[model samples]
Target: MKIVKSVLILILFLGIGATAWFYYPHYQIHKMKNDSMEVGKDLSRETYLDYYRQYSKQDIHHLAIGDSIIHGFGVDETENLVYKFSNQLGHEINKTVHYTNKGKNGMTSTGLNEMIKAGLLDEAIKTSDIITVNIGGNDVLKTAKKQDYYGAVKSFDTLQETFTKNLTEISMKIKEINPRATIVLLELYNPLPADHQFSDLADSLLPKWNVNIYEVAQQIPSSIVVQTTKVINSDNPQNLSQDGVHPNSAGYTAITTQILKQFSKEYRKEAV
Candidate 1:
């Protein structure tokens, strides 16, 4: 009887330890999110635009590429994030901002790399002063859907590895086409609601993928990673479209704001 009781106690302790390990990181993530919200609230579009007006160039040629987010899936043409970004950037700098959108509805990192390798985007890339890339979400979703939770988690390492390799090739191709063009890579945000079954898994794996993005950006000159996780998360259903997979108008606006903020920072850094 005592032996059975001792085994049960050990099992209970192990369960408690696992629970703590899981919940502790989530708790910290929650706190960090709240802090980020506070910081986001302080910066308005006007604030970023004002900074840009002081240091920005008089003209820009922006090229947008990647997946559905760049294609403005579930949103109208006018509500597209790239369109809004280009308009706002032009207005702020009092310049001509010509933009070309080459976004496909279901593009993956591998697809993008393949397209670039085929020289399909070479002309646009060569003429563009700015290029924005939004990819890897579809890649993650495809892997997650095809496997169990643990299986998906185990597969993320390989997914990220493949993504890193593809993205590096894509960046190199773009830079080879236009070394002067600045590449803006947007980090993927969790689209699952907090109470959703896959939310925790997404939250756990997304940062690892984003770290790959950041590391890739660091390798390529004139490239930067724009963080979207803080600005666009499952906390606000209104930010997402009916599909809950893509951003709504408001969400795109938020993303545009973040992108512009990065642009202003880059210009300021260059001016220094």
Candidate 2:
């Protein structure tokens, strides 16, 4: 009788331990996200534009849209894709490039469509020489809640359809607004390292989404999808930030290189 009682007690303790193990991270993530939204809420899009006007009195406008990657989420202004690319392009072309960023932390593809519909992106898009997008991460991220790879995969299946539709619509809208503006969509990377529990599934699923991004870019005029997985999120994830989700200094630098490469490719084609 005592032996059976001991086994039952052990099982109960294990169950409780497992529960705490999973939910603790989720709770922390929720808290951090809420705090970030609260902070970002006050800093409106117009504020960023006016700040740009103060520093650089130039007509060159480069608008960065989409999620936190585009927003430079866990990094300083210098370490963000927007500033790095803008600065490099300015130096390369001998033009003063004014950068405008409309990166939201928890944005999905649909959210981006809504933002465009609301005319939040109108002035920025119309004035932009180049428009960079980093979206669809949150769409897949919403599925990570299951903590079960199989379940997460299933969740991603549903999100894939809507993500494709919304992203296509977004590209069409951008083209309609400004046909001359080059649209560069950042490819998805597996933020979770290979050894991590959900890494394999994330890697497998991310590429599927990338194909959609590539296809959409191909269909849209003056648009290209920049690959990020091989550069930012590698086998060891060396370029990742401390959070293992966002990019570090090296990762952002890699991103800047890819963006310039795509532009160079077009410039060469045009010159030839």
lDDT of each: 0.78, 0.73
Return the TM-score for each candidate structure: 0.78, 0.74
Query: Model 2 over residues 153-255: C-alpha lDDT tens digits?
Result: 7776578888889989888888888886767788888877667877665655565666677767666645656767658765647678998888887789888
> Deviation in angstroms for 93 in model 2?
1.2
- What is the Cα root-mean-square deviation between model 1 and the actual structure? 5.9
After superposition, the stretches of candidate 1 with alpha carbons farther than 4 Å from their true spots are: 1-57, 148-150, 266-272
Stretches of candidate 2 off by over 4 Å are 1-58, 146-148, 266-272
- Candidate 2: residue 235 lDDT (0-100): 65
Best by TM-score: 1
- Over the stretch 98-195, how does candidate 1's per-residue lDDT look in tens digits? 89989999899999999999999999998898899999888877776788666767787788889899999998888888886778889889988999
